[model samples]
Target: MIILGLIAGALTTGCWLPQLFKSWRTRSTKDFSWLYLAVFGTGILLWMIYGAIKGDLAITVTNSLTLTLTLAVVGLKFWLDVLKPRVRARAEPPAGGPSQRSVLPVDARAVADGTGDPARAEM
Candidate 1:
């Protein structure tokens, strides 16, 4: 029974390491879902609290470790989604401006037919 408990703890702990490492190294969680991670972290925290209340060592240890891992992933996702993108967007110039290259000629037929806005017609 003790050996089984140890094995289960080790396995559960091992499963979270990969996600922790990936989030740590990349520092980017674009592909990760913040909503899912948030919900998952909340669930893990609840599990930890329940395990503690029940006085189950195995449940407590596993849930504690899982909560830590889930928090790391969730925090990274929040940073990437809320903070990093805003910083990047602020750094970039506004759109709808002139480019460095020469402008292409507009089609007269399209302009004559008024398919597009007349303001877009070439002089």
Candidate 2:
């Protein structure tokens, strides 16, 4: 039973590697919705808690490791999809320099609409 649990835990916990690698390589998570990551992470966390309460070593260890892996992807998504863009948007343009393209997609749109300062919208 212990061996079986270990084998099963290893397989299940390792299954997230491909997706995590792809996300890290691409530095993009546009295909993933914020809702999906949140809900799935929440479920994994609950499973970890359940395993802890049940005193199941394999379950607890596997879910804890899986949660860590899941959070890496979540952090990448948050950083690349959310925080980085906001930071870029807030960035000021170079002084006395030609206007450059906006790095943030939203700011680029604002530029198209002529609502944002072209200089500040610079990448």
Candidate 3:
């Protein structure tokens, strides 16, 4: 029974390792949903609290570890999703001429009249 509990705890905790590793390596959470992770982390915390209240060591340990892992991933996701973009947007551009892709002001009147320069009209 003790061995089984240990194995179960290990397996449950191990489930989060791949996600943590992926998030760490990519350092981008564009594909991850913040709300989903937030909900999952909350659920794990609740489970941990319930396990503690029930006095089940395996449950407590597994849920506690899972909660911690979830929190770590969620925290990273939040930073990558919310903070990194803002930081990157504010970062200084390299010492070169502005890229051709830079935004150009459009002539709304020309667009409305449908007789803007051929290049600008296409855009």
Identify the candidate with maximal TM-score: 2
Residue 20, model 1: Cα distance from true site in angstroms:
2.4
Candidate 1, residues 20-78, lDDT tens digits: the string is 78877988777777677778778878877887898878878888888877787777777
**Deviating ranges (above 4 Å) for candidate 3:** 93-123
Which candidate leads the pack in lDDT? 2
Question: lDDT of model 3 at residue 99?
Answer: 59
lDDT of 2 by residue, 9-117 (tens): 8899899899899988988889989899899889989988998999988888888998999899889998999999999877856676545643344467777888888
Across 1-123, the per-residue lDDT of candidate 3 in tens digits comes to 757986888897998999899879989666768778778878888877887898878878898888888888878887888888889877856667565555565666786787787365434
> TM-scores across all candidates?
0.65, 0.71, 0.68
Which candidate model has the greater lDDT, 1 or 3? 3
Comparing 2 and 3 by TM-score, which wins?
2
Model 2 ranges with Cα > 4 A deviation: 91-97, 100-123
Q: Cα deviation of 4 in candidate 1 (Å)?
A: 2.2
All candidates in order of TM-score, best leading: 2, 3, 1
lDDT of all the models against the reference? Answer: 0.77, 0.85, 0.80
- List candidate 1 segments past 4 Å from native: 96-123
